[model samples]
Target: MSPANPFTRRKDRIDELAATAASPSGGIAEAGAVDEKPGVSLIASAWSRLKRSPVFLLGAGITLVFVVLALVSPLIAPHDPAAGLLLDQVRPQSNPVPGPQDGFPLGADSRGRDLLSRLLVGSQQTLIVGVFATITGLAGGLSLGILAGAFGGWVDALVMRVVDVMLSIPSLLLAFSIAAVAARPSQVTVIIAVAAVQVPVFARLLRGSMLAQRSSDHVVAARALGVTERAIVFRHMLPNSLAPVIVQSTLVLAVSIIDAAALSFLGLGNPNDRQPEWGQMLGRAQTYIYDYPHLAIYPALCIIVVALGFTLMGESLREALDPKSRR
Candidate 1:
């Protein structure tokens, strides 16, 4: 056979090598194909991180328990929450069963109402007020923070100054003042007060997060690509900054519950005397402290336990969300 040209022979050998490299058994080629689906791999990596986080598991557990409690209280309560059984007034306390005078397992209040039932019902009110207030505060604060950070001039100064003013005053005093000034201590007024007090805290947190995010490479790239200011601020920066905000919001819910109870204890919430609020129950129980301590004790304990649960969840969420804590 005639000898192939030198260049052509070299080309044939290269082609053979290329074909071999394209085969499935080629380790480098197989690895390159595997790298194509990065999104799926990224999600799996995130799930792995979540699974490793003890704080995340604990927070999720606490949140689930409370959600179940709120949903099943009606079915779980042993007695009618609104019914007053006079025969069950001031019964002796027992763990397993209600005494003859006990309206329910938790004993009766001064009004002969079931303490257990009232607590079950009161949980709904606490959750409603806390959740709505936190949502309102988050929305308002996030808006202000985004505007301040994105604009970074007069707008920033104005928003920060307002936050400073709010923070200067004691939060409880501010809530109390707002509640007292309202025409009536309706649930709406209580919600508004709680949200108002929370706004400054949320604003500060978001503003700080936004300041850090504004300098990030992705944000800079988005800006360079001519993304609209609003879109860059909201769609791009907001989502990335939400981890800390979510953690803060969890703590804020617990704080809101405590604030609402304080407002009610000061006679600035749930206008009706018969309304079964934990704080209001405590207030009423004061009159029967000597004769029936269980009235106050039961409600107080319920508040303590519920607050403790939320506090633990908040701490867990904070630790889970914090990068430093993870490290």
Candidate 2:
């Protein structure tokens, strides 16, 4: 063959270069392109954000301490919570309650029981009520929400109307009413009342979340794929709808603790002094409120601190989960 012109050879080379550049992976685009990053899931991303938040750290710390104390109270407590060891030192006409004495670092309640021991032991009861109440509420809420979200139509309307009615009543008042309706006032009664009060809130929140998820792309695709309605609702929609509910449960923990205390304070909780609860202790302290402020101070402070911890953690979780808050 005749030798190709140098200019023709150069043009052919340029054309080849142009074609390569025009291809998908070429030229300035290819040179500037960065490696694709691995996907970060919502849970992991939210957790990463939570780890960096001072509020979350503080809240988690406080909650952890409270939980540890509650778990180890029987082992760590100095005296029997129900024992009236200091009864000899208390005189109704003279000293209504004792100040920090020999073995009683936090003094003693009017009943002559060790305040510190009562406080420590009380944590167990407080945790039980709070956690149980939240679980009960969550279970009830999830059932109603799923029914409404999945069935729609009459099911949705019926559930929403009931929720609205419940919401219209003040939560505390509703709790009181429910507790009163019970055959007797006890720890069980307190849990039932608090859970009932929380049910509406959780139900409404979950129903709304699931409803939003129903129209999501994944849910629609699942439906188009002929996935069973139950599978789509529980497997796909429910999981995606749970972020808000999880955060709400933390906040509800705080509320349930406070509600349980309120019930005990109002003489609607466990009446047995042998099983000391923060609210029960606080209830007994009411008579000595003016003379010995410490009687109520200790339990009250504990309730406040623990509740604040849950509130802070819940708020932090909310911020972390919020897409708007993400960088």
Top lDDT: which candidate number?
2
In model 2, which residue pairs have backbone atoms overlapping below 3 Å?
Answer: none
- How does candidate 1 fare on TM-score? 0.79
lDDT of each: 0.77, 0.92
Worst 10 residues of 1 by lDDT: 94-103
Model 2: per-residue lDDT, tens digit, 1-327? 999999999999999988887889877569978899999998898898899999999999999999999999989999999899989988989987888978889998887889999999999999999999999999999888888888899999999999999999999899999999988788989999999988888898989999999999999999999999999988999998888999999999999999999999999999898999999888888898998988888899999999999999999999889877555
CA RMSD, predictions in order: 6.3, 4.0
Name the 10 consecutive residues with the lowest summed lDDT in model 2: 318-327
Cα lDDT tens digits for candidate 1, 1-327: 999999999999888878878887875577666435535453355456767777656656766776687778878877777776644434445322233343356666555667777888777777788899899988888887887777888989999999999999999999999998998788889999999999988888888888899999999999999999889988988888877888788888888888888888888989775557777777777766775577678778767766666776677656545757755
- Cα TM-score per model: 0.79, 0.91
